[model samples]
Target: MDQRSELSEFLRSRRARLKPEDVGLRDHGRHRRVPGLRREELAQLAGVSVAYYTRLEQGNAQNVSVEVLDAIGRALRLNDIEQDHLTHLAKGKAKKKRAAACRPQQVRPALQQLMDSMDHVPAHLIGRRLDILGWNRMAAALLGDMSQLPPQERNLARHVFLDPASRSLYVDWHGKAIDVVSILRLCAGCYPNDPQLTALVGELSVKSEEFRTMWAAHTVAEKGHGVRRLRHPVVGELTLAYETLKLPDEHDLSLVTFHAEPGSASEESLRLLGSWSADQPVRTG
Candidate 1:
């Protein structure tokens, strides 16, 4: 991917999502050619000249200062992950200096132990590309036998969007899909040169129109905590709060765990489901 082109397009897309009224500009109720604030208007908001702002959007701000970047970031409403991505692109250090890092063959032993210990809650380990590294019996049951997929197609994002069954598995499929694509965009910005990531993006972009549209939107969001609602074939609908913790010493691995709030119907459902799942045979790759 061309870093310059990516940077330019990302900036322009973000800017286009915001309107004059969004940033406190009074709508003149006059006809406008574009959807969002004009170049001069944005530059004015960021306290920069039109030429300087235009140069930045053109990916030509070679000597841009940190303060200036921060100002532009605020103007564009860039989130934490988007801000970091912008800084990284501006510094021109996207290409890996060393050989591409090797992907892990399995989940770390400690993480495996951690997942196993969560007897009632569903937990799993996944890579940056949403590839399942490992999961407990509860996780497997809740997610519906993902191991049945070919090893290469075990990615959550791919299965969720590309596989038809997944459409009905999630209660709120559109919202979940958006979150998946947004997280993928964040990962792409972080590892622009990863071959595996590039291939995943290419495959999804071609295979799924929803993924393609969302990817083109250039959205970025951090994934740390959220509530997920799923319709399990066996257990009916379940709503669980999940926490995602990035593992130390591992660049792209994270531990995701889900638990229903106490005394709720969801919690009762999870308990029954976990008991049932624990009785099933475990599959190991």
Candidate 2:
């Protein structure tokens, strides 16, 4: 997670995904050397000088203004999440602080209690780097026993990419993998010098070729809500709709809750699973 390199690469990757025609620029029928808009073309679209934009893309620009970032974001057709990521990288380019040491994340008591009270729903508290900081019995039953894993290994990214069980658990395994990589990419932009994140990314990159490829794509996303189809070992196949609830005071923590549609087979299966695992212990990392 070299911040400067990440900033430059993120910009290049974003630029490489666009075409002149995509941005309302007509091609003059001349042979183009690159896949996307040239630097000068982008500079013109952003209403900035070529030299300035080139320096910005190279991660050498100092005192970058938010207005310029906004202009470049609009020119590149970046979404709200992508725009925030770009701004984070751009703002972090001038930092000189050393990466903070890795430490165990603590789950708040109130949050843990709330998750535990959700007896019928699968719920977990996710910390920085998608770490499963705390989980109730239902979550353990649905997503596997996180208590069996080491502290550092209790992460969603690790489950999605490194664990074989996840491939069977998730019907859309590839889509889940893509979402994990995209979420990690967005986190990387925000926590540029996080040592734990650096280690997690390195481990996944080494163990999973798919992770490597997706990481190179530099897609970024902030997961809000989604549907997940799971093939549970005990309950059989079930589809669940999930929503992310960001903790108000804990900026780095989110409570994820999943529920099946009312009166559906999936709902029955989920209830069955919950009833079957009622005695299991909650996993609090």
**lDDT tens readout by residue for model 1, 123-167:** 888787788878887888888676677778888889788888888
Per-prediction TM-score? 0.92, 0.94
Clashing pairs counted in every model: 0, 0
TM value for model 1: 0.92
- Give the TM-score (vs. native) of candidate 2: 0.94
lDDT for each candidate structure: 0.82, 0.87
| Model 2, span 60-146: residue lDDT tens | 647989999999999999999999888888887423333332445688787789888898998998887998889888999999989
Q: Tell me, what's the RMSD of every candidate? A: 2.0, 2.0
Residue pairs with backbone atoms closer than 3 Å in model 2 (clashes) = none
**To one decimal, what is the Cα RMSD in angstroms of model 1 from the true structure?**
2.0
